[model samples]
Target: MKPFTDGDFIKTVIIQAATRWFPGEDNRRDFMNIVQNTRLSPATITRKVNVMADHVHEQLNIDLKKCVRFSIHLDESTDKTDTAQLVVMIRFVLENGSVQEELLELIPLTRKTTGLDVYLSKKNSILAHEVPLEKLVAVTTDDAPSMTGKITGFSGQCLRDPDFPRFLSFHCIITPRSILWENFKYKNRV
Candidate 1:
């Protein structure tokens, strides 16, 4: 709470507190404790944070439109409470020759995550972003059956769909080959 007079600094404080799960009362107290007589209630902070998020989302959409080509990476895993979460990331090269990689979405699957489920969710996200499937050059995923299984996996579904553009599919390996080779050598030594 060191004296912060800048408006952007104030906004950053609110955003950080909100993201860090600070209670409403704590945020209010912190503002009150500030040297300046700034007024920031819990509700106001929440509203401001929401506005900031909306602005950032709009900027991301604009950036997506400027992408020359892009690739996606999908990974599905269960949370601590057994809730399935599909994490989608995107790597895109802008027209300016700069590449940007970002988290596109984290969709929580209310039901069990099947290959079809993943495909539909990803499709919706792509449509929402207004990104053409043709611009997608590749997709990377963890070699899970739901992601790679023929006829039932996400890539399989994409292959069957005529609307989907031709794109390379890859499996991201979790373990390094060197470590695997070392383990193999140790096991064979006995």
Candidate 2:
């Protein structure tokens, strides 16, 4: 048997990092060097980080299940790694009537990003989280043609779906409303 419990030692490292109690990587290496016996490999640390991230992801899905009506906010941007990525977030009314926004996932686009591709990626992520089509109250995306173009766009494709809520499939308003309102007021004043 090992002299020390690996699980406990690894958890201690996770806790320190979580609480921002981590001193420095060099400090940790120096300490481990001094200990010699309990020194964990770099690979082992990486594995533990992946394990914790998976646990957090599972918990987020569980939390998302509690909200009935949710609006998906989709944005496309390059990640730190310079890979094209899509970021998905959700805003929902909680049980207490407070709105909560949670970042759901990041999806890397391995190929060309078309309207169909964005729509499918969003659909897959939502389905994987077990958020039903009925509960998807809205989809908010940027004004980019791939997302909002009147034809062959993500919003247009959604509108074609019989299951899609006709009233909510259109993206959350981000523009034009103010312009229209101003025009109306100006005409009325004149």
Candidate 3:
């Protein structure tokens, strides 16, 4: 049998590892078996997986630019590593009568996770890096006060002047009527 080259073995191991992480049955034994079968070094396999992710991200960036209007969904959650991270996802209708979603970014909000100003600044930076501000039609997020404030700040900053883009916010969990009623009640009490 011909000896498998280092690159070939690394690619095979990466594919196997990626399959385990992808949506499927959590067969730990099978995964471990595959890891043992591959002759490549673990570091090599890790690097290959990183490279594959980067390639996919580059391709998605090219495809997103062709979208006419796109909706962004932002949410933050703690990962298994206990790291507070912001996940920004984009949804758009393609030209071929299909809807597509891309995981635009996973930003580690290290210092900004606890502070309103820092969080908003980090969120704004994430938006600037992922999608063009002009292409965003709507943003959807949860009903967290900090998140709502950040969305408001983003709208104001982006639509500050006549030349800037006008983007709207859609709080998925809050109705406009309820918000108005709450505000009215608060004003009457004051």
| Model 1 lDDT per residue over 87-173, tens place | 899999999999999888999988757899999999999999887678889999876788987798999998888888889999886
The C-alpha TM-scores of every prediction are 0.73, 0.64, 0.58
lDDT string for model 3 (1-190, tens) is 2332365655566667766575555665567567667656557656777899889977787677666677877676678988777777889765675778988877776664543543465456545656555667877765555466643443443444353457787766764656999999999994
* Backbone N/Cα/C clashes per model: 0, 0, 0
After superposition on all CA atoms, what RMSD does each candidate show versus the true structure?
9.4, 10.9, 11.9
Model 3 CA deviation exceeding 4 Å by range:
1-39, 80-82, 114-130, 150-164, 174-190
Clash pairs detected, candidate 1: none
Work out candidate 3's RMSD over C-alphas.
11.9
Model 1 misses residue 1 by how many Å? 15
Q: How close is candidate 2 to the true structure, as a TM-score?
A: 0.64
Candidate 1 RMSD computed on C-alpha atoms after optimal superposition onto the true structure? 9.4
Compared with the true structure, all predictions reach lDDT values of 0.82, 0.73, 0.65
**Best candidate, lDDT:** 1
Candidate achieving the largest TM-score: 1
At residue 120, candidate 1 shows an lDDT of: 92
